[model samples]
Target: MTAIPVSAITIVGLGPGSMDDLTLEARRVLAQAAHDKQTVYFRTIIHPTVEPLKQDLPELRIESFDRLYDESDDWSSLYQQIATEVCDLALQHPIVYVVPGHPLVGETSVQLVLEQARKRGITTRIVSGLSFIEPVCNLLALDPFEVGAQIIDATNLAISHIDEVAGKIIPTIPLMIVQVYNRRLASEVKLALGECYPDEWPVKLVRAAGVGEEEAVLEMPLYELDRNNFANHLSTLYVPPVPELSALRLPETLRYITMRLRREPDGCPWDRQQTHDSLKRYVIEETYEVVEALEENDMDKLAEELGDLLLQVYLHSEVARQADEFTLGDVYEHVNAKLIRRHPHVFGTVEVDNSSQVVQNWEAIKKQERASAGVDVHNESVLDRVPQATPALMVAQEYQKRVIKTGFEFTSLQDVYAKLEEELEEIKQAASPEEQLEEIGDLLFMVAKLAGFLKVDAEEALRLANRKFRRRFQTMESLAREEERPLTSYSRPEWEKLWARAKEAIASN
Candidate 1:
């Protein structure tokens, strides 16, 4: 068997649609390759320019690796296979690979082939031709440089990528997105874009640019992208710059209200049976979710969790409405009025410099209002007003904060620390389990007070410490497993060694 001599790879750019659009260099290379009896391959002969050339060059072996693309479900895998095959063919014989427009522009297959050929020590030449971008720009009367343009593959649309493009690209500049292909892909593209651009943002869908039977430009709002039925492989999505901030609150509020209605007496049985007492834990859970959302800086999750939290409020309000106490509307009206009343600086003539002063003013106004409403105002103890339903740590912290405000608390951090130490000593000296438990509670209360004085939320501080301890202990357990020992079988001294190692590892990280 005779081994075929390896041939140089020539990438020819067919330019857009017409032969007039083809560069002199691209035409020269194609003609020369034909004259030399070299095999000519078209990446895609579907282009109008390449369609006419088929007649002049009957022997031009067009690369219809379309079957490779058609057979593979994954485009990336197909592209890789196509590039590999082209490079293998180039290694065997001199080949002229023809691609639509500039081979260097938006041609991933050409890029792959060139890269693979380079690795195989195969000589490769790229003949540049007029790209579809230039022709599209001409058709739209757009200046690519002056207006600025971003060319993105439609298939690669993702929320984060769209956000990055929106952030970097100036809003005044137009964006040209190529290879939209289908409605599902178009919808995905729209959803990604919807995060940055408004739902009503104008987008132009252009198909078959520079071709004679080219369809007229179709216009639609960004939200109605899927509604446009003319999207295809040769289509491009053009998005004009948007300046408006997307309204995110209204839909969230609607969702909250709808969920509550769905769970009403005439709705879900589980939800209908729920009362204020039964749903108490849900309120606390939703509040924590809101805190988590805020901590994570996740606006979408925050919006969702906030809706859950709102549902709790509306749930309680609906229960109250059943008992003829208050309706959901009444709950809103009360809170809205309370906020306006409390922020006298905003709703009234009262002037306040900072948040602290505003809080003080609010408390003062609340005391006066409670007295007028025939509510008790002669609360003697600092802890008297604290809600019994609140978590023990939070209640203790609130009691301490109230006492400190009245200048009837510990003088300094040292004083609070000494009190905690005293409680610990009492716990150690306790004669019975009941006495010990009481002392331990006292100790915890003092610790919560100290945490409050330090401007730390006692509940959250404890929760974080609990999480850290669990993580460290888990690491210790894993280390024990590595040592072929169970955590339960380890002695105190051995456990301490592993725990220390875990802490050290955590600190190092």
Candidate 2:
């Protein structure tokens, strides 16, 4: 242990407000601090043991910060200021810092105190006490270790999106949610958890566990968590382990499937041989199929195509994981963080009028994020993130879309049409093949920008034109065959007659 000095600080927990729950060492530290006339400060004096401690240590001058909770609007800043005060007071005298539960568990102030104290070269000591988790386990009649319990703070569950696991928790395990300080927070927790757990699933709410004042334990459907008015600082939630396996239970099922395909010695050779580069074609293929299903307006086909697309993701991710590049969790974390950070209208207090404003705000947020990461994004090309592998027509449209955001695009389709006409004239006047090629490409790009201005999908438009031509030509060939003449044997006049009839046939249909 570090040598105790006049500047040393001893931190203790009051053990969930029950006198019997306080450990012997914690009590001894309080007694010694009182006997020596050292400063003893309680983070809050609202605990049941506060009066008992006052009677036991009559000489102790215990200061309380209960009023700070009411005085400060921001809990983060409040905890920060308290930590500064604790470190400053410790420098002048040996002190005892007491809080309601174990100092290391869910106490933000204690963490800040340790960080500040360490930076100032102050000696610190910890005397652990019983935390609310112990009594909660007792009430549940279950061993946390045996049940594979996962404990989380309700505050974190309320504000942040969970990306590492399903249901915001590990599956096949019990979960203990602590620090549910109000009904609003309880409702938020229930909503976030509802993504992974059924709304009708039973959940237990425990309040003031091991305290003298009545401990309330209520079992209700998860949907009703915010209905009753039993929430307080001491409230906690218990989610029992799922009885049967489910898709929502774990994402690990997909991970396991991928693992067996690649890890087993007798696995399919095609799967075992796939690398990131080798699987790229399948990723692109599956994505286009999904798009095709959407274009056809078929939900059944869309679902099957979506699964195939997911398979591509799992295969590529597993390949990278095997190569020690990254895990699948890293993929979702990147996207989840981007979603929360970009959509301030949802996750934060920012308000907006329409989707247009949301798009502008998203770009602004992305720029700010880049600046924070020490990137000079203003110097980078506006089309830098558009993938090279994307379809050429789609890429062209995206280029025009992004450039418009930078205030450097045609204001209307009239300007796009003018550019297209100018490029077509340039292509016709070109002497060299290279010059003609360059001008032709420019003309196509202008065409794509015009399509974008008209709110049309340039790529899909080209696909439809290609389909129409193929269908007409096939009909022409069939007419030639019916007339006992090969399509190649037809004269220009005969071919024209067949093509006109084919067009008339399709137009009539």
- Highest-scoring model, TM-score: 2
| Candidate 1 whole-model C-alpha lDDT, 0 to 1 | 0.75
> RMSDs, each prediction?
19.9, 10.4
Question: Count of backbone clashes for each model?
Answer: 0, 0
TM-score of each model, in listed order: 0.50, 0.57
**Which candidate wins on lDDT?**
2
lDDT scores in order: 0.75, 0.83
Error of 1 at 135 (Å): 40
By TM-score, how accurate is candidate 2? 0.57
Q: Candidate 2 — number of clashing residue pairs?
A: 0
Q: For candidate 1, what is the TM-score?
A: 0.50
Clashing pairs in 2: none
Residue-level lDDT of model 1, residues 1-509, one tens digit each, is: 22333248878788767777778777667666555666677765566786667676665555566576457666446557878888888778777788877888777778889889889988988888888787777667788788678777665553245546455434445788876766776887887776656788888888778775674578888888888677875677888864322323333344345455655456667766778899999999999889878866899999889989987887787777767887778876888999998888998898888999988998899889988989778864556768898889988888877877788777788998889899999998999999988999999998898888789999988878887998898888778889898888988898788889999988988
